[model samples]
Target: MIEFWISAGLLCLIAMGFLLLPSLRRNRARAEEDRTAVNVALYEERVQALEEQHQAGVLDEPGLQTAQDEAARELLADTDGDAGRQRVRGRVVPMLAAVCVPVLGLLLYAKFGAIGAVEQARTAAEAPGTIEQITARLERAVRERPESSQGWYFLGRTLIAEGRAADAAKAFQRAAETGGRAPAVLGLWAQALYFAGDKQWSPQLDALTDEALAADPSEASTLGLLGIHAFDERRYADAIGFWEKLLAIMPAGEPSRQGIERSIAMAKAQMDQRSNAQDAPTPAKGIRLRVALADALQQQVRPNDAVFVFARAVDGPPMPLAVKRLRVADLPAEVSLSDTDAMMPELTLSAFEKVELVARISRAGDAQHGEWIGREQGAPRAEQALREVVIDALDKGASGNER
Candidate 1:
């Protein structure tokens, strides 16, 4: 910011020089004109005396001619070879303009220029470039602004990138304490804690991931962490389920897509191998439900509208345990909610003994809120018989149905 102001001051000086130079030259020219006028007045007086002597007959024609010639010689010798001068112009206008130019420029700039943005840009350009330098800067920043959530958050992210997960966890904790506990922040905090614990699963880490997913089911970091945990535990099917959801929400052409896809394929291969083994575990049966829009609310929905069917634990986090998406046209559709449809690996349908089944119709395709919704009033066993969920009511701030 200081450098920017110094450069701007220099440019202003250059501009002032342009405005004042011509005025300075004009003042010098006026002084020269005044000297010329003095010389002309002296010459005219000498010529007038010569003419008076001739008229008085004190000099004959030849004598007067010699005198006039001598006077002309003296006049020419005194004046030298200089151009005739014009009347001097007033200096007030030019001087006033020279003074006003810089002042007016400053005033206009103050009114219209993006001075704050310029300062911000300069600050950003001069920011620490290397990871170590940035980490140091962020550490200092957090210390100075202890209540700044953004500072703490970035510090945590930098620490994580610098391979200091324990320090990162503390930083993330500070960030959350400073009111930066958004889903992304929570996910990153959980990730840092998980890695700092040598990838060990703990109740605290589980709660963090669950809290993040409760806020936003599609939080990428939490989903990725869960998938990695499941895969490491040899829960290949669960890992595949988690990674598939992660893969679906990831933007196309992402640089990390290939790595995630490879992981998914590996998990699937492992699952296939385990299924072919003689000691394979039987797959757990999940709840089955038939969903259909009520006749009264049918006109309020479109064929292309999204339909979400899911189950959530009766007394657990708000995030869905298992979810399946379909279009309104697919209803009266039959869908199954199982571990394979789990939103997160650890939060599968079978993990909870009793769960509530819900169906919703959303025109905007958001699973959290919908125009019409239906659900079973009582919690049922995970392996309950196939049931029908009629989309019969308006979803007006409905509880326990949020994704």
Candidate 2:
């Protein structure tokens, strides 16, 4: 910034030189012209007076000639060294203008120029060559602009990449607070917290994921995190469910799609292997329900709209014990929710004595919030069979009002 000002000042001086130099030279030329005119007038008057004196018989031809010679000599003497003696006037205004030009230019620039942006660009151009340098720069930036959510988020991501999970978590938390707890920000914060705790699951992490999903059920980061957690815990079915939802929302040709697909296949394989190894007869400890959209709302929903069928404990946690995702086009479909469909190993449908079954139509594919809903009138036993749920009621506060 100082360098920029110095260069600007030099350029201004050059411009002022261009303006003032010409005016000073013109003033000097005008003064010389004025002195020449006065000398010429004085010579003319002396010659005329000599003619008048000679015509009046006051002097002879020789005397007049000598007088004219004297006049010419006097004129030469008067004009001698006049160029050096004469002072060029009218220079004050030009000098003042020369000084004011730069001052006024600086004032206008201060009012309208983007000096701060210029400095930022200059700083960015000198990119940090190492991770440590980059980290330090980001730290400084966040300190200077604490309200900048993006700055904090990038800093968090950088820290995560550098294997500083605990610091990353703190950065992500700050990002979430400054960013209005946006779904993506919350998801990242939860992920950082999970890794910071050495992959140990906690209620705080769960709450963060829940809040993020409540805002945007299709948030990819939260889904991915949950899937990974389930997979690590050997909850193959739950992992498959979470990964499948994430896969559906991911764009085609995404680089991460292939990995997620591989994960889903592995989870499915694990589930099959476990099922095949079981020797004991598995009793029917599950709920069977048929779900269908109402005839009146058929026009309001699209064929590809998401349909979520789940069971939640009647007097327990708000999260679903078991969940199955379907589409509106597959409505009037029968789904069975059992321990195999549990979202968590300890929170299976059979673990909840009394549960409420619900079917929701979410055009945005959000399981937590939907456009319409239907549920069983009262809490029913987990093994209740062949119940029917109709999607007939408007869902106001879909997840929150489910109690």
Candidate 3:
């Protein structure tokens, strides 16, 4: 700015020289013309005095005439002495050119000069270039405007972005102290405290988050931070709950939606794993069996045929509660069906009080039906012995009643 003012002042001086120097020259010329007129007046006064002397009879007509001629010659000499001033007289055209030169220069400068661009460039040169410098500037701004909640909040956020969580927590505390009790401010303050405490979920964090959520139930930052906290503490179900709420409130076309959904999926998987682990110690349920083709039906079955061993609720849905499969060559092999082998979460062997075991030989390797089958009915037991099953007859369901 100083440089700008200095250069502007210099240009103004140059313009004044163009404008005022011409007027100064004209004033000097006017002074010279006034001096010439004074000389002519003095000569006229001398000629009048000589005529008066002749009238008083002090000189003849020739003496008076000679004196007048001498006075006229003296006036001519005086005019000739200032010949340069008369030759180069000041004119209206020169004065107009003097004024126009400065005016046109100013107009051209305004049209062509990039003053705004230059000023921006100068500002950029003095801009902060490092984290420390920016932090210092932000701190200064906050200090200068102590009542400005926005400035303090922005400074806190900037400190957090720089990974200075401890310092950021202090800044956020200051903001919370000075700022309105808005949900965003409270959420941000809680988030900073959560990180500052090494991701621990403390009572202070809970209170802050509660306040934030009480004000704005859908505050995403608080919800996200809570989810992260629960996940870090191995509370996967809690994490899923918080993240699902966050997902529900998120606007359409948000870029982080996919990432948040992925996080929720991962949390759900972790939740399932935790459930499985908790259930591992509980008593197991299901049946054990050994299946084979009867000796009498040896020639009726092929070695490459597939065998399926399964159980289903006797009076409930026909879908298998659990199942295992093998090739005919591996028949007579023992197998167990347990809740651990359930096909789906909602369906398990332990869910039923009674089930029927069915073993079948299907050349097509399908469990739905087979060319031959054998069956037994019993209560689903957790620690039962392997009961022998022999397939010796044709599947009679095709002939009459479907089993």
- The TM-scores, one per candidate, come to 0.41, 0.53, 0.47
Sort by lDDT, best first: what order? 2, 1, 3
Give the higher-lDDT candidate: 2 or 3: 2
Candidates by TM-score, descending order: 2, 3, 1
Judged by TM-score relative to the true structure, which candidate is superior, 2 or 3? 2
Q: What is the C-alpha lDDT profile of model 1 across 251-327, one tens digit per residue?
A: 99899999999999999988888778847677778988888888997677888998888888887887889898999
Tens digits of per-residue lDDT, candidate 2, 224-254, equal 9999999999999899999999999999989
Q: All models: lDDT?
A: 0.82, 0.87, 0.80
- What is the alpha-carbon lDDT for the whole of candidate 1? 0.82
Against the correct fold, how does model 1 do in TM-score?
0.41
- Highest-TM-score candidate: 2
The local lDDT score (0 to 100) that residue 400 gets in candidate 2 is 49
- Please report how far candidate 3 places residue 85 from its true position, in Å: 15
What lDDT is obtained when candidate 3 is compared to the true structure? Answer: 0.80
Off by over 4 Å in 3: 1-3, 14-36, 50-155, 170-182, 201-207, 282-403
Model 3: how far is 38 from its true place, Å?
A: 4.0
